[model samples]
Target: MYHSILDTSVEFIKGVGPTKADVLKKDLGLFTFRDMLAHYPFRYIDRTKFYKINQINPDSQYIQIIGRVISKKVIGDKRVKRIIAVFKDETGIMELVWFQSLKWVDTNIQVGVAYVAFGKPNLFNGTFSISHPEMELYQNRHLGRGNLTLQPVYNSTEKLKKFNLDSKGIQKLIAGLLDQVIPQVTEDLPQYILDKYQLPDKRTALLNIHFPKNQQDLNAAERRLKFEELFYIQLQLLHNKQLRQLKFKGASFELVGEKVNRFYKEFLPFELTNAQKRVVKEIRIDTQRGVQMNRLVQGDVGSGKTAVALMSMLLANDNGYQACMMAPTEILARQHYASIISLVSDDLVKVAILTGNTKKKERNILHEQLENGEIDILIGTHALIEDKVQFKNLGLVVIDEQHRFGVEQRAKLWRKNVIPPHILVMTATPIPRTLAMTLYGDLDVSVIDELPAGRKPIETRHLYEGQRLRMFGFMKQEIAKGRQVYIVYPLIKESEKLDLLHLEAGIEQLSYQFPRPDYQMSIVHGQMPNADKQFEMQQFIEGKSHIMVATTVIEVGVNVPNASVMVIENAERFGLSQLHQLRGRVGRGAEQSFCILMSGNKLSKEGRIRLETMVKTNNGFEISEIDLQLRGPGDITGTQQSGVLELKLADLASDQIILSEARNTVIALFEDDPQLDKPENSMLKAYLQKLQRGISFDKIS
Candidate 1:
């Protein structure tokens, strides 16, 4: 009953009829009064301060003046047409010009009438002018500093402008709707929260956000709205997390027995870093609780996350349960299988590999071994999740690069056994803390911040396209020392629209500089046949080739320790995360490594920052923070598709403090009233129940 007024269709609003309502729906996706209410203004302009016509210079920004139009005239030819009016204030005169809506503006504008004009002033030759200024007749509005108030400026489109629905027109319609709706607006936050935060009620916030009485009220309203939006998201995430802990029973891997101890003592290559040890302990606690573990393990490239994963799986093996690791691509799965095989002795733990590349006869044998518990550990691509593949006792599931697979596919691993196994999702791309808090809110996060010992930081450099000869000379020097080189391109083929260096042309140009017999280059890309691609890759891996030129397909899964030089062509065309990953490919060996970022002279501000960031620091966390600032949360590795970061107003980059506060607030609420069963929290519980009916966190897995 409380929401019925807000749920009324926008077409029923007095100022918005069928035609205008359709326009609003198509342009802004605003269908109801509720939608219109949430359509916030992008900015606010102070209408209290007014400048005289004589005071506005070229530098004056968005000033308002009380003026009267003395005369109007049409100037210029039809192609360069405009309507110009001589507008005079008490002090002096200026020009108001309009390029569009000439007929309507010229027709309705009256002569010698007191009016208020708002726009940025420009010095047109000798005189001052304001083009397409917003004009309104001064009835009771004042232009003094004492009566301080803000006027909202909303976002609009050309389509909305056709029907006299620009920012000002939209504001007028909202004003009318607020008059009828404000009385029925219920408080979003409870009284205790409102008092603690010193927040205005929903009624005052709605009134002040659109037409703030003062700067103080506006700030309070913004805080209220931003907090509430982030608060609800954290609530849903926490609620789902709590429900899962209560409902699901996890397979207990109680025995950390012989295989794990032997792998650490004999098979393990290096001592584990302190960060990795901390993360392993965290995961151990989660698995021992007998509650299903849904944990995300984050680390940079060459951080030894695989070692942690291997040790965890050995726990399953010790407990007499099978484990599987799934990757999105066959190459990655093969790489993982090879890495694990090299690290573990097959006598204690039998490890097997399965992928799309497996032969039918071999697959049948592998399947039979898997079902009969002959396979202690299985590593594969999407083939591991297929219905035909069944495990004797699936106890642990590890997903590499979790963003590449859909939610349903990962969820399939949960059903492999009667009880869901411990889930460990790994990603080399470091996520910012704010984004991590929101996107992976339902799961526990552990970051391996420290790189392995004896690993030297790769020296990164930015070179312009004109330095191609110099780069090739450096590549020759690196290859002369028996070190391999990787040259990556953004595009596989030439694209007329983009000016990026494509692989085909890039390789052709390089072949001339470093001739065939001396250079011995191997080319790889996505378009190549799998067998051919592997053949080229093998040549590079075995040190048969001095230079491996490829596309970003070599970003992951390819780890050649001898490849000490990475040259990325058109580095500005890629984002920070991609550039960081490409840089990680070269720094695997004990030898000194270098990454050369080559770009065109012409670069966007963000592109420059990306290249500069790579050249400045080797920290993946810092690079991810900068990437979040540049590209935002939505574009960061398909977080938009997950729907968890569908924020209305909270910016994950700048609103970190607010996000943290909201999360802490939700945590406190749950701590005080674990199930929202207290009388004081009744409103929050009811709101969650209603909102949950609309959104399914389960779909996100």
Candidate 2:
């Protein structure tokens, strides 16, 4: 059995005592041997060769040199001492200077002693020199593997330094540990499988990664590990998909009769976009089929996805089954309830709201109604998952802004009923088609590509810090026309510790500029309680507050048709997709909306490019594509987002084609010999077993 080194205490390891172990545990979170093993080198230092002192040009880059100290002199005072030494190599002579460690260097260095010095080469006056260079005493037997190859450099805490354990010390410890852990190369995979895939043994790969002799070995080790990590993740996802498909069947709501048709003809405020109709049709067809529906409906902000969701819920109600919509926040859940209540006949379709703040009596009543199938649709936050809550024949479960929830939470929802409800996850963030395919490979996806009639696009603009006065004047003009405004800051509280700007300062500045008595203003941020945030949001939505200065907490939920202007402070601080989402909060109504991005004068090149892109187009998909190019997939979806399949060797952005090929290879192998009972297929099974740690691939069987 393979053992984790994390089980061993740091004190048990050689070179680490009680004092050092305490520092490691408290400061670096390194309590065991495995922690140090996993703490991979941040960078490598090349010490392959040494340069002659005289041969070194003034403009030459950093190089190591072997030289003998000819003379040493103490120049400066005790408080600011400087030790200057003259050294001569085979080619020429140079000066070696030490600043703070003069006493140590003076005692250690002896005239005519040959030693190795490593540092950057620079010219001062007309001579070549190295200041405060890292040096080692010359001894043929004590060379300590002098600059022979690349050396791993680790990261250590200041506390470790106090205990005489720094980066170099940690590196030596890891090197010694590698020497003791004998390679236990078990044949987890068949020999034929290893040959076909050209994979190294697991033990060899692990050892080489920590102590590689050359670049080729490092590359091979990395390839093996990355592939193994991604393969296991993919295997787990595929297995989950199989288990879900086999274990649960959705209640198919087939009829599209009076209620859906009546709402479409009379109650619907606007005609359905062709994209919306297509997605609705896809959902209807999926529900009609006997299998559980796991689909993702992605659309750009303001693309009318909520309308499609409401229509699907209506379909379920007509077929005599209850449906529920779960949002990530209370405001969003309330918004959906209000919007749907306005569009549907309340008598025909009963709707209820359940949030964390719901009264206990009300919750009990709602639970009873939900369990008895009296409520047609229930909308809420995560409180919907409480053990007390039950649904009578839950036909459909629509998750809004699905990325906010984790995989385990989604799985919990699926288990609420014996036959899992038809799952439709919706997101306003428009992901590119390629990324969508990998991230949501298991789910059938539907896209809503159009907005409703009279939905005007917001005009976007980028302004430098110098143009803030002009932007303020423009905001005043917009406010004069009875339009509300949202001025968003980046932080919640003013912190004396941080050098960055805070939201409280922005609120103070805006209050001075727009002066609260003249224009009513309110502030909201994450630090505020939920009720206070909702109260401030309510004031803005009711037109009681003319200008609301808040943080990105308003990015997802707050919907105000009257708010015509969106001003994002420190616009460069936000990611492209986030900026787009914030911009989407406005332009919800017929009145033309404006998005003003205020950036600091000193902006990064990428930041400038991001701002320029935001000004160029309102298409969230285009912005997402650019974001993928600039920041990569990890930042776009966040590292923990469920749909983001973590890859080891392949980049989801750059190596899409390669990933497709690998996926195809796996699929073809599985299809040709499902159980892998044949000899040729047995190797593939071995490869899968080596890759998928605990997850099983019995779906093929």
Candidate 3:
């Protein structure tokens, strides 16, 4: 019977029964024939040869043996049956044992029967033995010229196995499916391109991927799949970019005012870095061209991205247009409002702050003022996107810490304006260029590579717990000079059951060491309510609290320039990028800053490397790249839902050369066939359809 490939009936698959199908569908989200085809193997096992009994070491757990059953006996009771047998090969004799499977031995083995067994070898009572080894009957037809060949092991759910469907059974079903599908699988790639890349045919790749004859075949199959995945993704991103630039037209603001020039001449704190100037110029050019700007501004922590964003907003304000900056949190919003208000004269520019906590009466006033164009600059969190709030002429939308906002949230902001205000997304996390090209290929990228003048580089040092007293003494000396300090911990609550009780215990210890009576101290964590947390943070900012003890909640928004010293407990537990972010909380002002990383003695090699990288340089990009290499791309971006690129087969750090080549290939293809509608581009179209199954195809158009 023929079945629809996309049908949701799991039982229709060859080996999946009702109960087993439920387990596969519920546990793995595999409910269709297409899902099974896409569920690739995690690894392959080689079962080509058998080793002699004498050649096996006692510690060897995975081995194959060819032997004959010399003797058999049952040792345990009926409730707990144990069967043991002795087998002899050309080299020596070994014991084979099974637990709770007496019937299996009786039906499968006899005194003179020869079989092949595979399992881990163990030593019991000075005899080499294997327990519950997987066995197959030996015959002249089954035995190759010598032994069995390579085997494929699949990942399986325990629930499915209870219904008599396991990894081996799934493997058999996939093999059968591939056999039937191979003949129908026509080539979906251009012959010239395939030849240039030396990729195997689609049918050969599928067959070899499922059941490879040798390592070379497996390698060839892997290359074909990885290249195909990346190529299609690149094609989609480039096409989307072309459509956006061609179809959308943005409102352009004329440079007709001296407000920005006056602000730059009279109120500017310091000179703009070369990187910042270059990026601001790019934004100006985009705005003057009357095209919607979808640009990404990326930089390391304290690399002056915010300054460049402010300059862009100034450009919009000079042309009688309103600008809005959306931060991820209320604290960051308030901080930006304060900083920008100080730089620009309050009389010329009316800046307003709107957060979730703003009073209803006050919010109503701000709403009216914003819609009437009385407020030229507005800063807030997600609350700014509420329907009640409106902008008279929103020319530019600057999203700080862009990763914190979701795609839907950003879309809401876009819908607020008639022309979809020009977007400028900023992030402190330094993404490597290769990953940026693959993930954000649809947006123009502007990077700020320089820091402002008189900004001292944070001096980082790694220390063990044994040096705690010395570190404490240093902290005391620094605090004596009237400089504030920040002591950060990983966890908020104290847990007696956890081995790492550093955060809570350290708080208590510091309270005693600094003597809270002498120096005002406060603590903040995520568990605290927003009001209470803000109160404590205000106390620190107002100089009422000389020392603030907190978790990573204070990592992003809190800007305390006076807090020159940062102490991170259990620093090794954090990724390198996280450690750098925590370090960035300080050193924002003219005062020199220091970051002390306290790690335990039992540090792994990777953990040691992370700590050392933090100490060696304050360069966020360099540390981020190293962190990506050591911990991998997943952890560098935080969770899977962080909108960071999730490549199945590509490693951003290791595959740099391949990524560059793929990008160049994509640009060239689009240059020749912009819509990919040429007869020669049919293969590319089919390949993209197969890769991005459920995503909307209109994104390309």
Candidate 4:
């Protein structure tokens, strides 16, 4: 019954008839009373203060003045027409101008009449004026009047403004609707929750949000609404998780057999970091359990994620089940294949690679081998999920850079085996704890926080254009030491808008700096043919090229341990994550590596912060927190795809404490009533059903 009241059409509201209703829907997506309630104000104005005309200055942001209109006149004609009025208080006189609705403004004005005006103050010709000020008769500005209280400033489009539906108009319409709906707004939360959280009832919250009696009321209303929003999201996620665990059965791998032992004993490339060992054990426990394992392994760049993934894959093979890995790009897939081949050289594991570039005959052979279980581990791009490539007893799947694949693509891979395979998703881009809780909250997360032993942190320095000669000398010295260099440009072609260096021009400049016969050079960019790109990358990896000039295409999958120097030209143009990934390309070997960020002398505040963050620490999680601040949650690569991040008032960026509290409360609630079968939780169950009907979060699984 309460929901029905809120779901009534806006056209049924007293002031908003059919015409205004259509405009509101077309302009702001407000179809019902519920929509209007959700459309919270972006700002509020204090209407109690009135400034004298003498206090108006050029620096004033927005001011309210009480004065009488001494004179009025129409100035200019047609397109440039405006109505000007001279308003005077006892202190001084100020000009009030209206550029829009000139005829309406001119007809409504009277000489020697008092009015209260509000607007931003503008100074021209050594005089102060208020242009397009919101004016009202001074008699209506007394205490207890509407204009004497705090006013909500809502967001509206110009199309709505055409029908007198700007912020003020919307507020008036909301006032009319509240009169009818506020009485019917019932509490959605159980009585215990309201008491425990010290939250106001639903009707009070709705009333105060649209028309707060005081600052305390506004803050309380905001807190109650934010908590409710975040709480429901947590409830839905945990509920889905519980259902998934109860419904889906997993294949049990009860053996730690030949293949894993062989790789651990002889084919191991380096001593396993304790972090890596812990993560591998976690995967082992998950696989052995009779439930499907969906885990996210997060680590910094070059933190041995692939090593852990390979060890887990070997565990699957030991139990008579084949494993497959999927990557976003062909290059990463091939790189993974090469790394796996090298790791298992002394072992008896069969590994195969399939990608778009693979020969048709070779692919046919691979298809046959894979179906017959001849391939123990297969690494490929999207080709791994093709209908023809079937696995005999697929047990585990590892997705590299998991955010690059959409939900549908991952779903296709999960459906390959009758009972879906154990899933391990990996990412080098570290996600903050709050984001991980909301974005991948359902999956069990494991972090390899520490880097491996014997690896030195990359030395990063910020350099400017004036230091070009010194940078060149340093590059020459590194090349003299038989180490390679990577010079990355932000763009492939010159952009007129951004004054950053491009890859083609960067290559030419480097060629001139170190001429042929002395320094070997290679170039790579996105526009190059795949064969050409592979050839140049392979040349750099083989140590045949001393300097490689490229774009951010090398930000991933290219692992050259011997490349001891990364020179990022115009590095300020890149995001913190991209810059960090590019820097990760180096520092893979024993010797100390350097990342020299080249930028112009002048930098924006954000650009300086990003560069400073790169110079401060090598902690990916810390960098990610700052990145989340600079670029909001929606702008981050993976967070937007998870529909949960589209929060209205509860900020994942700022409200971490509230979010944690909400999650804990929801967890405790479910402990007592798992299915929400109690009468008190019926409202919560209905709310959850509404959220489920609107969102399809199946992608997270």
In model 3, where do residues sit more than 4 Å from their true spots? 1-10, 48-150, 254-256, 630-634, 639-647, 683-701
List the candidate numbers ranked by TM-score, top first.
1, 4, 3, 2
| Model 3 residue 418 distance off true place after TM-score fit, in angstroms | 1.0
What count of clashes does model 1 give? 0
lDDT of 4 by residue, 1-701 (tens): 23566777889888788999998888888888888887788766777777887777678887789899999998897878898999999999889998886655777778888988888998889878989887768886653324426677789876776677777778778887777777777787688888998999877887777778677899898888888878878888888777777877878889999888888998897999999999999999999888889999999999999999999998889988899999988889989988889888634799999898989999999999988989999999999888888989899999999889988889898898998899999999888888888888888999999887878999999999999999999999999999999999988888999888788787778889999989998898888999999999999989898998998888889988899999999999889988888999999999999999999999999999999999998888999899988987767664467678887677887888888988898899889999899998987787767666883321000
Q: Higher-lDDT candidate among 2 and 4?
A: 4
- Model 2 alpha-carbon miss at residue 198, Å: 6.0
Kindly list the per-residue Cα lDDT of model 2 for residues 577-618, writing each as its tens digit: 999999989999889999999988898999999999999998
lDDT (Cα, tens digit) per residue for candidate 1, span 518-615: 77999999999999998999899999999999998888998899999999999999999998988989889899999999999999999999999999
Candidate with the greatest TM-score versus the true structure: 1
- lDDT of every predicted structure (CA atoms): 0.87, 0.77, 0.78, 0.85
The regions of model 2 sitting more than 4 angstroms off are: 1-42, 45-183, 186-221, 271-275, 360-365, 406-412, 430-457, 499-505, 515-518, 527-532, 604-613, 616-662, 673-701
- The TM-score measured for candidate 4 stands at 0.90
**Candidate 4 or 3, higher lDDT:** 4
Query: Per-residue lDDT of 47-142 in model 3, one digit per residue for the tens?
Result: 766799999887785888889999999887878888889989989999999874456467667888888787789997878999877676766425
| Error of model 3, residue 159, in angstroms | 1.9
> Among all windows of ten consecutive residues in candidate 3, which has the lowest summed lDDT?
692-701
